[model samples]
Target: MTSSQIQVPAQEEGGATILEIGQQPDAWREVGGETDEGLARFLRGITERPGLRVILTGAGSSAFIGQIAAPALRRHLGCRVEPIATTDIVAAPRDHLEPDTPTLMVSFGRSGNSPESLATTALADELVTDIWHLVYTCDRTGELGRAHRDRANSRVVYLPERTNDTGFAMTSSLTSMLLSCLLTLGPAGRGNVEALAQAAEHVATLQPDIRALAQSGPQRIVYLGSGALAGLAQESALKLLELTAGVVVTYFDSPLGFRHGPKSVLDGCTLVVVYVSNDPYTRRYDLDIVAELRAQLSPDAVRVLSCEPIPQELGTATVLPGLAHLDDAQAALPYLVFAQYLALFTALEHGKTPDNPFPSGEVSRVVQGVTIHPISPSDLEAR
Candidate 1:
């Protein structure tokens, strides 16, 4: 169903998430129109500097995008590109920051209002001498978004207007910003539009099936993947846990890691979703885990998402379609559509609103109650 078409109890209306999720295909197309020459020069600048370091920073789902992008981008740039959360940087700047190294702090935020996002940027300005900012956000109007638009070394990439999510949870906002980073980082992201278009069209057709599967009300959920998909797996887990308000127990880890101590969580009622990696080597481990889980649990217990044709041959497992034509980084957007739908349908099954999942005032659309304390000179010295 389209976002606006989703029906929930009057007390639990959640149209924002549904609409956000549905509009992602459009957001994918729209964000492509934006271009920043300064941002382009900064990317080239990284290659020219000998000791330059790139730090991809954000909070919550925004942070996960950094995890997904850093590894791929590091290889693409052939330099040190690290994914460190603004949450961590704000709390302990000494370990993550260095005044001697030329640093580029790439900040990803949905609203750009979170105290830490800007606070972390501020900290960089104070502690690092040769610091630059490349900020990609859905809301160019928010405090962090507008704060540094004129900085000589900084570049702000404001995505399509529709991407600034009105929903409590980030749907288009998350994927679009993540896609933007991938698009900026390397060749892998350059070909994403064609692949994302196909995947979006494909996902639109599968919503009914996905919704039906989610209504079964599995008591527990597990998401597994390898490489960049591993980070997306964590974001998916967070989406469900937040939407369900902790009513459902969820866990995320890599396929091989699941076998170590985590495999005990599996049971008859547990639904396991595996994001089959686009990498051939990683795909083998993913398939192996699926085989093991299906053999140990029922074949019905495990679900695999992949672009591989061979998964169709696995009779015991349910295979969700993926965009195999795109590389892992470029294809992450389409693969994430499945996770977004799962969270949406799962929340609705319980008559809960996916948009504003938590009314307890405990969790919020924007993180609240944060105290951005000043980092002292003493704190700057690494212990």
Candidate 2:
């Protein structure tokens, strides 16, 4: 069954978002091809430093990039890597910062103008005595890039200008920064950037099937994954919530974690989407949940996405070929594109404007109504 679908064109309200979502493949190609010697030196220095810790920070959707990249970055860099949101750093700097540790704070921003974005970086400078800054932003003119560009001990990498999404949600901007960060901070290999982009392009073609899923009128949506894909699930859930303007309730959990009481949210009106892992060990747990959900729910109510095909009796799957060799983190790029497309068509299904879901401005493109309080040296002393 199909509803009156709103096509994506320049004239529609969702045109920017639709175009941005489609532009990701090209944008990724550009980011993946870019090389920066200074940025390399900055990262190389961090890797060589003894007792160094890397902290990835951002706000809202921007923050999820860190969550998606942290595990792989840690394994490749051989150091402590943590994904701490800029919101958390702003609200509770003391708990997350280490004054004496040699730290490299990687900041990911779409606009790079969010109050928390600047505030968190400022707090890191004040709190971490021996610290360096690595920034990835789509906006070259944004305060986050401008403020740190010329500063000593700081290196800023600006992604392709088009990645500065004009739409309300972070689409190309999020994925570009995540890709650039991984290519720069991860191991020496540049990876198969062309293949990754091609996989994302393939996901874009699945729009028709995805739109049908959206049109099914499920009141609840759940996204589940394991490892880095778990973080991808969080971002996937956010896309649905943002595009639908909170009309559709969404939940995200790790495949194994869902068994611990979180699975009770399932109902007849719910649709469950699972991202099966490429790792042999992790795939076992991911498939276990998918099998369990298929047994309990109608086959139509569950969907599985994997890099390779699963058993037919387990149910239908959207298999992204050529990506089976990718680590879970790299695989997240195409998985995210699928989630974005589903969110877009779902927004149109509900007759909501994808570009600006909240017409009344209850929520905004860049967050509003945040007050960044100054953290004085005395405040630190008291704590």
Candidate 3:
């Protein structure tokens, strides 16, 4: 059965539910056997065009997806790959777009209804002579998908039906979209996709363990990642904060970048979660930070969760495996699931509803209260 097919038991009043969303990683196995030929075909069409400069754009969580995908695409495709927030693109098109450039824009959206999302796509068409769009969205009938229908240079990849999550926070949708992108651009002829999917499923089984750790102690959380994973770190931090309704003060930093200034944020109450890379060069930086933190941090006061096992020198209190060899985008699935588990546990600890943590009504699943401005003639002429 698919992950979505598994029913979550109802939670007792003012108590944590036995069904942990973080374990969705284990459900990835259901998708493992399937081949992503559609995504591969789409990538081939985009890459075949000469002089293609690719822009991966999105907003909020979707923007974080682009950030993680950018580095991997640049390294593997040997093409210029940039991850730009749709908000930024809409506000300053000239800064991100080139009029004469042949561009392939990859957009990610959950609802695909964000105002900036449609505006950014329109801006690309208006400013660039040769612009092609690849939209990855969970909602098939949403604005982004509908906008691409009659357009010759545009294609929309609706995520698996199961990915259309009803929950306020994105869970399954994020992983499916990120995995689709990895298969689209990753090394060809290697069946690591199945392995990656299996790993995700395995992590799902560890949700209970993750929740236990998250509920143990440490009110402050710090996430460290490098390269493409840096975006994953940010997303992870945001997920914990949002799901817990800011019950946990969270921070994210690049492994090396953390030492520069952000390391000061780590203290006795901090729980440091590190997404270690398989790449040796990047892993060294991640390990180094862990080493420094260990020396200064009291073992009882600070909690450390590493995605992979570190040497004895780093002294990680908890290690979760099955992340090695996976790309940062794909690795993010298990890590995200773990964060969700932590958030839920933390929320329950504070007597908050994991489903709707912000009982005060400050935030909505779909953001509200933003006014969009029309592009002016002066803006066009400047480009």
Candidate 1, residue 39: Cα displacement in angstroms equals 2.8
Per-candidate alpha-carbon RMSD to the true structure: 2.8, 4.0, 3.0
| Residue 248 alpha-carbon offset, candidate 2, angstroms | 0.1
CA deviation > 4 Å runs, candidate 1: 1-14, 189-191, 311-313, 316-322
lDDT of 3 at 322: 55
Question: Candidate 2 residues 251-302, lDDT tens each?
Answer: 9999889989999999999999999998999999988888899889888888
Q: What number of backbone clashes does candidate 2 have, counting pairs of residues 3 or more apart or in separate chains?
A: 0
Error of 3 at 123 (Å): 1.1
Name the regions of candidate 2 deviating beyond 4 angstroms. 1-13
Please give, for residues 43-106, the per-residue lDDT of candidate 1 as tens digits.
7876578877899999999999888888788887777999899999998888788888889889
Question: Which 10-residue window of candidate 1 scores lowest in summed lDDT?
Answer: 313-322
lDDT by residue for model 3 (62-174), tens: 88888887887887788888999998998888888998988999999888888888889998998899898988888988999999956778888777666766666677777
Task: Give the TM-score (vs. native) of candidate 2.
Answer: 0.96
Which rank order by TM-score, best down to worst? 2, 1, 3
- Clash count per candidate: 1, 0, 4
Provide TM-scores for the models. 0.93, 0.96, 0.89
